[model samples]
Target chain A: MATTSLTTETGGFEVRRLWTDERSRAIIFQLLVVLGLALFIAFIVSNTIANLQRAGLASGFGFLTEPAFFDINQRLIQYTSESTFGRALIVGLLNTILVSSLGIVAATLLGFSAGVMRLSQNWILSRLVTAYVEMTRNVPVLLQIIFWWSILTELPKVRDSLSLGGAFILNNRGVRMPSPVLEPGFGWVFGAFIVGAIATFLVAKWAKRRQDETGQTFPMLWVGLVLIIGLPVVVHFILGQPLAWDMPERMRFNYRGGFNITPELIALWFALSTYTGAFISENVRAGIMAVSKGQSEAAFALGLRPNQTMRMIIIPQAMRVIIPPLTSQFLNLTKNSSLAIAIGYQDLVSIGGTILNQSGQALEVVAIWMGVYLSLSLLMSGYMNWYNKRIALVER
Target chain B: MTDQAFHRQQAELLPQQPAPATTVGIVGWARTNLFSSWSNSVVTLIAIYILWLVISSFVQWAFIDADVSGTDRFACTSDGACWAWIDQRIQQFLYGFYPAGETWRINIAFVLLFPALAPWMFENVPGARYLRWFSIAYPVIATILLAGGLGLTVVTTDKFGGFMLNLTVGLAGIVLSLPFGIILALGRQSRLPVIRILSIVFIESVRGVPLITLLFVSNIILPIFLPPDVALDSVVRVIVMVTAFASAYMAEVIRGGLQAIPNGQYEAAQAMGLSYWKSMRLIILPQALKISIPGVVNTFIGLFKDTTLVIIIGLFDILGIANAMVSNPDWLGLSSETYVVVALFFFIVCFSMSRYSVHLERKLDTTKR
Candidate 1:
């Protein structure tokens, strides 16, 4: 009775309880955290300002408009040393996008093939694929880049460059390939091609519906291919053969008048694709494995052919597993394009480095780099998320 | 009645015939795996052709026609690889311009690394527990050996290059990021909104940018944060940035491990009347860390490869040293040999790590059973 009275007699909650109470403790800790963070940020800002003042450098975006005195070897748009830094950065950004897109396409094709081959019944083929994936991924990509660059550069000089019947020329400078020159009437051919694509889409939808309703499949693949390619060719001939090839011609010193892809681009693209391809193949293999054998067996039991089972049952499930990680791979490829600096490919990071060196505005350049990459990452993730949702299984 | 009679007669056993000759031994295995269908047979033939072509060409270039001996570029007569370039500069590849006499320090560090790493990696080995202390002390000892403090002749950070620099940066990044990663992982999952937000911001931002940009930041911007008189070594700066970048990735990997832990485990720990930190320390972290081993190793491999990026910002890692060697006037065009050597070195390390992780995964897969 005395102990109970002593506990009840205290007007306020016990000081120990207040300190130990999880809720109150959490609140107090958070407050202290907020205060500490504020102090830290303030310190950093003040320090930066003081350093900037001492260095006699004003910080802003005004430097972007200043003339860039350096010339770029490869530009997607018209630009010279007279161009502004902003234009140079834009050119760099485009080059980065170009390489990343091409790399993604090549890597996906190679990776998917290798991934499927890895699971092939042929022992030697599977082993070879495994070797490729393991060896390619383990080595540093920069080494691969330098190696490719050196191989291309070591090619015999322009005079003795390898030629493929005057259609293509290979030299240390670049591979000169025949460029397609489209005439005025090619627009009609292109329009016909677009029409063919739309027709194929409609036909495919009809075929799918027919397959569902009557259990009858159409030759959609063959028909679609014919419509797209045949229709375009027919339109081209009817319009008097509007497309012509401007073949590369060997000259006194080098090839001229064609699409000359520089060795730097080739090396950069090859290294990026092969390196990223190994990783993508692993993802693809894992995705395929994640779907149990029972799924294919079930489809087979339903009387579907092997190809049909793969197309309708297995691929859909595997794609769900593949896409999220695949998005990260694409982002990685985009980021790795910056290694172009090592080979002088002039991607965004490489150009930014040049700008930073010339202007001495490290802060602004870094901020720009972080901002551009963050936006790209976010955009890719957003699109992938939407795609993932579309393919997500609907529950009962 | 007829069906029953037939079944009884069939059950009266007959001797099973041997499998057909085409369906036995290696022949049978080949038939099923490589020629089960027309398409399969076609693919098999094509694969064999491609494989033969590649192997023959590689062998011809690498062995039959290659010049492995005779000192200089002029000695290379065959139109193949010039491995003599690598043979000549093997020392530079292993230890980029540290005073030749100090080479013993690098050798000691290299020899010590495996012994230090072994106990931690294979904890179940006999007497491993006794050597656990050595693992903790290894990094400090290695730094002192490399940098030369405490009465030893000091080697400046710039002199630290080649494969040694790669190991230094990779090991430091991977080891130092772990504890910070755990904190960030926990913070991201915290009940407090501010802490969670901060963690998310840090992880996302770091992951968003490329390692190159981050390296640039360390090289260029870090010095400005300190007073003019205080100069930070470039190697230290780069290591700090790498650690920060790696921790962000590590946090996400750990978060995956954390999420995999069922709610019941957390509830059971809480129901025992243990406080948050105590319960987390004793109950949560061990399980989460155990589950995170594969992912952590993958991150380690990535960080190891990324250590080569330091070359872009002017540090001489293995790739940088190799790149420099390629530009040597004597070895003007032996880029293939130099890069191949670099690739082989990285491949051996990374491939072994990947295989070990796979083995760990297999060993750890006990829950299904």
Candidate 2:
């Protein structure tokens, strides 16, 4: 027994020694890696400093306040060639947001329709949708942008503008339409809208809970729609018509006295929406197909109508598959909005480029560009994550 | 009573008839598929009418009414598409300002690349392993042939910026990015803390921003970053930016493939006493790459299309050249035709690449039970 104990102790010591050697080797390897990284960082840092000093250029954000001497073709806010660089950047950012938001709404609607049509029982409709998706999605988006811009440019000049009745006008300058301007008491109407929205949300939640308990459905959608739309209309009437319209009138050479959307914005928005819609359509189709036929059949077995089955059984499940890819497309559209630069729409990059050239502060301009884009990306991803969690499979 | 019942059953059982051929043939298919319901039939009729209208108009405009042979803008006054503008400026679009006589050099380079690239893509081709190195080497040869660096009339990078230039930049970026992407992907999955951190930072920083920003940095700020006398061409700047952007996205794709690999594969490699790099190069990458072929091809397609964005930086890529060509005094109002032709070109190339990707996905599918 003593001899066996002695042998066990020796074996333990041997195992411990082996472990120590292995641990030391790992430590050394890790240390070497860290050392290498530190050295590389230091090298880059020094090189940057040396290069900056050699170029006799200052690297700081002080240039943001300097006067931007360049003129923007289109501006969302009041901006001029004499505007501060910061203001110019803001104008660019606002334009980017405006185009992207419009594109997203339009693309989503179009995409959902095409995606549904692609799966139709009718062969012709499905084939047509497939052809559209294939043709549009496969081509380069930049090329599409140029294509649309060129098409817009091919329109007749302001003198020989294409007039659609009297309400709308299209020319090389832009498309002009009657636009609404808010009058007095519009604030009250806006307040009513907010109240209606909140009430609709609460009603929807209550309806859902009541359905869960009683196994009875509610006309939540109709109720919500009436509450939301009717309240605003009622408020508007009570406020004695809270908005006025300015209809465009034809002048000697051009349309006057109404809101005009520049051709650059229109081309960018059209190209982005159509191009992204094609991809989104494919994603939507895939999402729908992912829902098994058995699920729909089961809903039918429960005496649900076709539309009812689609709304309740199919869409809920499809959302799970659709949301992730949809978010990516949204991000892509946002990024692609920068293509407005090509057509001189003065998006963030274009404005930034202008500033960079004007101020010779390339590093500062680039850093700002990176920061804004990165923040936008992060915000989008964060929202998507929250949305995904809401609709995720609730495994007990 | 039993006899009556038996007779009733016998009478109920009539002879079975064959299905009508018309109901199962092309006529039936058209009726059911194209004109099943009233609404469907109406839609079909409308579609046919519209299609006929469009086709006839297009054909008449494109061929019947178009002016085919004139030098000035007034020669294209026909109601149809002016193929003459395209014919007039075809060389400008393809070769940009490259010397007309030396166009053969680009042609020869393209011919050489095809044979070199074909073998690399074909698994059944002989010397498959050697083809990998050849793919790497062929680009160098093509670059020299095009750039004319040694004992030849050197074409400046600025002059070389055109459709072929875009293709070369995209292709070169893809080639350079792949190896870098693989390394970064492996490092991200590595046990080492430093490598993991570095890989994550590199990938995320690049991916979180637009490629335009990166291009801006490369174009304007890269010169500042370099030494005082070091002047890199705009083409080089664009190429570097493209490669950097591609690698970041490729790293994410490869990491996805890496995550998909079963841990047992790694364990089995270790059990076989293969070193880390050997295990990765031999066992892991082959499987991961196979699993990620569809994604890689998609990235390739995206990069190929995105090369057009170089136009924003004043490079005369295909789309850029087309845009410029349309603005020529002789073809001022022909922007629509030029754009249509360019869009068609892009559609063909990108569509084929996507179709090839789908085919590869099917061929490489190994998930069947």
Candidate 3:
């Protein structure tokens, strides 16, 4: 083809040939794109520098060391108003991860339940699930957050707080629950718990091997559960009962001496979980539906029980369809946690907003947010990709 | 004797009768769908009880026991919602502080949008082809009417709020994103390495971050990036940011559509002596976009929802205005009523869009036919 093209085009230098040739045209178009992009970037950079200088703001990481001097109520790390901006940002990041992780767990559980319920044999239940999903999903998530926040904050104040027999306390301040206080000898129990987990893995592996070799099935699940829980209990007792509870008591003004979860965290967590769960339910439904009915029939033909069919056949196949979209839902939850700012939940965005206001380093603050969020996105996608590869179907 | 006895008695075959009442109609439906088993009956009863509880309370709070005419928080009772707040501020909710007399301009814009969009939305309607011109001209006309640039009282970006603002931002993001998204998708698929990399980077980086940060860029950093004299309207900045964010997602959706097209189409176009641009324009995109209608609509729904993020940066769209109303001293503690109203509005829009997408999917299901 190359020889024919060269020989045919050798008669004379034809201007029309230049226009007709695809390769030359492609190169020219690409060059134009590159040039245009470069020029645009240059223009923006020049403008940015001029504006920064004119506004009398130095653009760099110098502002990060300055004191944040802003209060954050729902931080995971130790953070004070006197903390540096960098420390405050870290606190914010930790809070983001905490909310996101907790939301992901709750959303997954709720979503899977709802998704399965939507496909249930009962007509009323399925329709109710449908209504729940549609109603929750259609409205804006930010509105849901604000709505929930308002509802929580409207609860009666600390003095008139509602309680569940001195165990769980609820008020406008937040929910106070009895905190588990681990005593000195609890380390032995924790160690035994880890050992039990390893033993469970070994037992499952051995059961599968035995089943493959001799056609004998062992109840690994029951054994594993017993081993894990029993071992922990045995160790705890042997260590002289190393667990105690710090029950929240109603003090003069408020509950004291227990875990005090702020209203902001509760509201944010509930809103994010419920909102993201709606979308995740759709994904779960689609994934389960993607698995053909034949697979379950085949499992039954092989003498598998209903529970066995789901665990060994249907769920494995359904997961292949579920994981990809489920990853995006997880990432979306992480991103949506930024809405915490609307309800005064001092998340990464809220803290960054404060820092931007205080330091006048809008450029750097924005960059930090983008960079952190992008890295988080990349990391999540990478981990999900690895998981996908592990569970991927192997074809010969 | 045996042979005579063997004269076979004719068998009496009775006509078939209808099934029992318990096995037909509503009774049968209930037996099978609701009370097939003990567990099912329990679930059905539980569902009914829950539904009754929810509906009764909702009706009581939203209608029967509600305050519909009172003007302030003091007039509201804790026993029920005060819908009167919404009724009183309905004008502000629909047309945020756009001088009361000039609200007709917004109304005109709102009324004109359907006729413009109808040609494209319902292509089978008669005379749609001729009305395509209206769709083309509507954006400019609506902008002129709303912004009041051509010999009308000018309304600045700050004055744009409420549902009008939501419509403006959402519509602009969706309409502007499509063409740009298509370009980016095509660029990602292009043979040129430079263009492919550029498209990938733009798409990924934009999609990576939450939209609130992008709104921050518009609010705080966008001006710094532009030349000193060219101060962009904040509304325009938001529109631009939303378009950029949405186009990235749109590009991925369109790319999925593009990938579903077999390579034979490309080869066939090449064999016809069609240039790359010509083939993409005439042969490729039309078919790809036809397959992508549902996905595009989904992206539009998501973009519409994301427009609420603009409120985080102090731009008062519907959600923002609702927030403002909640915080207002006169309307304080009426958050539930305001939220319900706002939620209903959004639900209606998003739900209809979802249903329309489903309908379109069925309509375009050529494989079934």
* Winner by TM-score: 3
DockQ of 3: 0.85
lDDT of 1 at B347: 96
Clashing pairs in 3: none
Candidate 1 per-residue C-alpha lDDT over A1-396 given as tens digits, one digit per residue, 9 for 90 to 100? 532221335565565654556676677788888999998878778888899999899899899999999999888899999999989999998998889889989999888888888988877788889999998999988888888998999888998999888788898998999899999989999999999999999999999999999989899989999999999999999999999999888778767888889998999999999999999999999999999999999999999998788778988999999998898999998888888999999889999999999998889988988898889889988998999989987778
**Whole-model lDDT, model 2:** 0.83
How well does chain A score by TM in each candidate? 0.94, 0.87, 0.95
C-alpha positional error of residue B261 in candidate 3 after TM-score superposition, expressed in Å: 0.6
- What lDDT tens digits, residue by residue, belong to model 2 across residues A1-396? 533232344455443343235454556777888899788768666777898787677888888888888888788799988889999999988988889899999999999999988887678778777888888887888888877887887779988988888778888888989898988899998898899999999999999999999989999889999889999999999889987888988788667988898888999999999989998998899899999999999999999997899888998999999999898889889988988888888899989988888787888888888888888878888999899999999999
Off by over 4 Å in 2: A1-55, A185-220, A234-240, B1-16, B38-56, B123-136, B149-152
True A-B contacts kept by model 1: 0.75
For each candidate, give the TM-score of chain B: 0.93, 0.89, 0.95
Give the per-residue lDDT of model 1 (tens digit) for B134-200.
8788998998889999877899998988998898999999999999899999999999988899999
TM-score of every model? Answer: 0.95, 0.90, 0.96
Docking class of 1: medium
Clashes of each: 0, 1, 0
Model 3 C-alpha lDDT per residue in residues B269-362, reported as the tens digit of each score: 9999898889999999999999999999999999998888888878888888888888999988788889999999999999999999999999
